[model samples]
Target: MKNIIINFSVMIALLASCSPATEKKVDKKADSTEVKVNAIPAPSPENNTVLKSYIPVDLSTLVPIDVLNTKSTDVYEKYGIEFSGNCYSCDLASLSITKDTMIWTNVCDENDTFKIDDFSYSTEGSKTIVKTSERTYIITQIDKAPIYELVVEGKKLELNNKRVSRYFTTKKALSLFKEHDCGDFEG
Candidate 1:
């Protein structure tokens, strides 16, 4: 009886070790297959989807003299421009361009704003105000039309040319402008 119990214990230990070895082999195979799948080449830039074209601009050149005369919010209100294209909207506000990336803040309202922090080159054209940003905005200057293209990360986003009226009374529109931080209105 004692010999049989010892034999049973040894067998159980051997089976446990074998199971782990089999599992390790399976895991190694799966890892190799995953590596092989990941080795496939990504698409070339030329074969990539349509991209937006961002023209680097000098911010100093676009700053108007009148900017000092009025509040920043008022200045943006007087000259702010937006673009609509495809199904997206883009507002052109304060733009800072670096060697690698262009930092653009969209003046959505008098205050509410968002930044396009990681914009790079794209195939789509840009539509911008003549004196606001140095980049020429090239979309039909109509009430509703597709405007410029802004590429964030690797994705292309369209800027529609939609002007916000100075006399807009909608509560949402008012709130958007107030929420958008346009820097110091006094300075």
Candidate 2:
């Protein structure tokens, strides 16, 4: 019994030493604060970055007024953002979702406005990812609405996520923005 136990212990020790430690590499770029682990470098989109990039704003007041996950609003009711036009001040996109149909329109008056590509969206947990046939749109929640940070695929457009830069006050945008504004919109 003692010999058998000793042999088993020796075998376990040998096996432990023979196993290789899995190495995990974490690389963080100073520019974009995203930390990727053992990341495979994606072919950089000619006009876009792989991760969501935003201008850092003082959001101290915004958080208190933000409706992160409110009871009064549902996912479908929230409008998704669209950024187009070669200029940073492009017009916003609009979505009208009904029981049977979904409509997305580029509302900018500029002819240079970037258009939302033919894409579909699905929710991965609370985050909704909008993807075109070629690339995925950078979708994130801002003021309770889905904002897409995209690099106009074919154009030299610099489109910024409007939620952090300015307030979206369209009728549909207002419906959801009011929920977090803590203003007179109680419905």
Minimum summed lDDT over a 10-residue window in model 2 is located at 56-65
Model 2 residue 87 lDDT score: 26
| Runs with alpha carbons beyond 4 Å of true place in candidate 2 | 1-92, 95-104, 108-120, 145-170, 173-187
Model 1 residue 49 lDDT? 40
Q: Which digits, one per residue and each the tens of the lDDT, describe model 2 over residues 149-172? A: 222243333444322222232343
lDDT of 1 by residue, 1-187 (tens): 9999999999999999999999999999999989877765444443444333334333211211111224453522432222221113434344334434433334443243333443233333333222122233222112111112222222233434322222111122223332223344332
- Prediction RMSDs, each to the true structure: 16.5, 17.1
Each candidate: what lDDT? 0.35, 0.36
Report the C-alpha displacement of residue 85, candidate 2, in angstroms: 9.8
